[model samples]
Target: LEVATPAVRREAKKNRRLKIVGARGNNLKNVTAEIPLGTFTAVTGVSGGGKSTFLIETLFKAASRRIMGSREHPADHDRIEGLEFLDKVIDIDQSPIGRTPRSNPATYTGAFTPIRDWFAGLPESKARGYQPGRFSFNVKGGRCEACQGDGVIKIEMHFLPDVYVTCDVCHGKRYNRETLDVLFKGKSIADVLDMTVEEGVDFFAAVPGVRDKLETLKQVGLGYIHVGQQATTLSGGEAQRIKLAKELSRKATGKTLYILDEPTTGLHFHDVAKLLEVLHELVDQGNTVVVIEHNLEVIKTADWVLDLGPEGGDGGGELVASGTPEDIIREKRSYTGQFLRELLERRPGGKREAAE
Candidate 1:
């Protein structure tokens, strides 16, 4: 499909870059790379082509150590520059946000706190003198004591795996009757948690804090997920996107550098489109996003491309091509460009014209 150029491309006058000089990390040769700030740049190549070695082992680790004071050392590299232009760096990976069942999108994104506060402000809560803590399922007061607020009871079986059944007391609602009694628009706290992110977006439209968080979740194509779905149930891509949503909702400093490795893994075509929109919006806000990607849709839309490897492993790690998609496609040696040329040519746009 025809992809629109990012707005950053139109105004890249100063051309500030994050330079990785003389990198020899893992399978990488003594390579040097320049990643432009405030653009969506993709690092692409064959498997084991040192994409990970160059970006993750070298760039991300080095940037983290220098900028955040992290002790993790980067792989062998001569020098890194232009880190001063960034105040923060985030690596959004596909790791679970929490290990326990109590963790969910609402809790991770901090929307649940405001949801509790809003519940506490209700007239029924005020009349009963119920504090915000009373609505918490994690605590004792308003939780279903029968299940210890897990909404389910786990029964141990020797030799057999543990079995869990819904709580008879609260009927898997997590909250006790008193907490459930405090309602907003006829829906209880449990009812709110049961709502999908898209449902919650409309349900809490009048509430700014809650609405904004739900909106971010929806923007990342997580509208179908329950507001309180267990973190353990989420796939890797879903978890990664949730992290992206949380970051998107935060106040942008316009100097944050976001790095992602294969974010499109396990995503549907529609979901990938949504992901791109969010990434480009970050660039529009003057934040730089560098992704190690192989997806054609993602590569086509990137403002810049860094194609590594004429081959994989021992034969790879050199910077085979580095430029716009147009520039990369013209380089005779770039395998990424050979494939990218077909994609860009299939659609009519400036990217396609440049490829021609």
Candidate 2:
């Protein structure tokens, strides 16, 4: 009798995948594909090519409802198997973390709370009978009373645009004098917020809890943004990176599936490189990362590529090619493959094996 070897058994185990068959939602025309687990996969196509309908509407939505018990309904599909391996699914999109000036990166990531606690534990803060609540700009005690912690007073001119002038009490600093007096290593809490993420990382280096979160912000290419920068001031890409950084700071479970839509929407070449590094790191940690991307830089680096096309709109939605980047280049019907051909040819020894 023929017996399977250890290598064959390992290969068989690795070949286990998430199978989606006869997915006919929106523009997706009877799509069927098997995506490997514990690998970085990219779903690429042109505008109106049904990438979102397939990945988000079908895959992510289905997974969220099944694994996460989400109330939202997924698009129509025949079957989605192999979800038993996953514990949860997270969709990281480019939505703003906050709508008001009161919301900032520190507050969104829960890092500000610990930072405030650290400030409250300071020797000066203890002598002054201050608590963690006193360090918050959202509250009354530590914040400037004149501007009500807004740092700027908005004067509404009905006929003309609103005029926003600096706060007279704190001079644009949100905190009052007493709160500012509580310093750690010669820098107050407000001062720390004013510093860039890179500066904050260095400033809080001795404090692991605060330093690690700040370091994540820097790692995700947000080193230039201030810790206390207004949430409204950030662009879509910046907000997404902030969210990415927040997620990165957490201890990830290996069974989690991360789905990102157009992660490289507004990223520059350098920033894209940083983003790719972080994404691959996630996959390295045994988590599956699926991205709906058009950037060749991102697509080429993926362990597996699922190219959906032939044309956009009515003519598209079929899976034209599915394999490694090199395998994609061989498919004539795939527009993404046509573009990737040039990239793959130019870079010597860039061919990677497709994830099973």
Model 2: how far is 69 from its true place, Å? 1.6
lDDT of 2 by residue, 1-356 (tens): 11111111011136558998888887889999978888888999988888899899999999999999998777889999999999989999999989766788998877798899999999898999999999999888999888888787888899997777778889878999989999899998888989999998898888888888888999999999999887877999999888888878878887888999999887788888889878877876668889999888788787778888777899888999998777898998888898888776766443233334
Candidate 1 lowest-lDDT run of ten: 347-356
Q: Candidate 1 lDDT, tens digit per residue, 4-91?
A: 5433343342757899999998988899989988788999999989998888889999999989999878999999989999999889
In model 1, the clashing pairs are: none
Backbone clash pairs in model 1 (N, Cα, C under 3 Å; residues 3+ apart or in different chains), count: 0
| Model 1 RMSD in angstroms | 3.1
TM-score of every prediction relative to native: 0.93, 0.91
lDDT of 2 at 277: 75
Cα error of candidate 2 at position 135, Å: 0.6
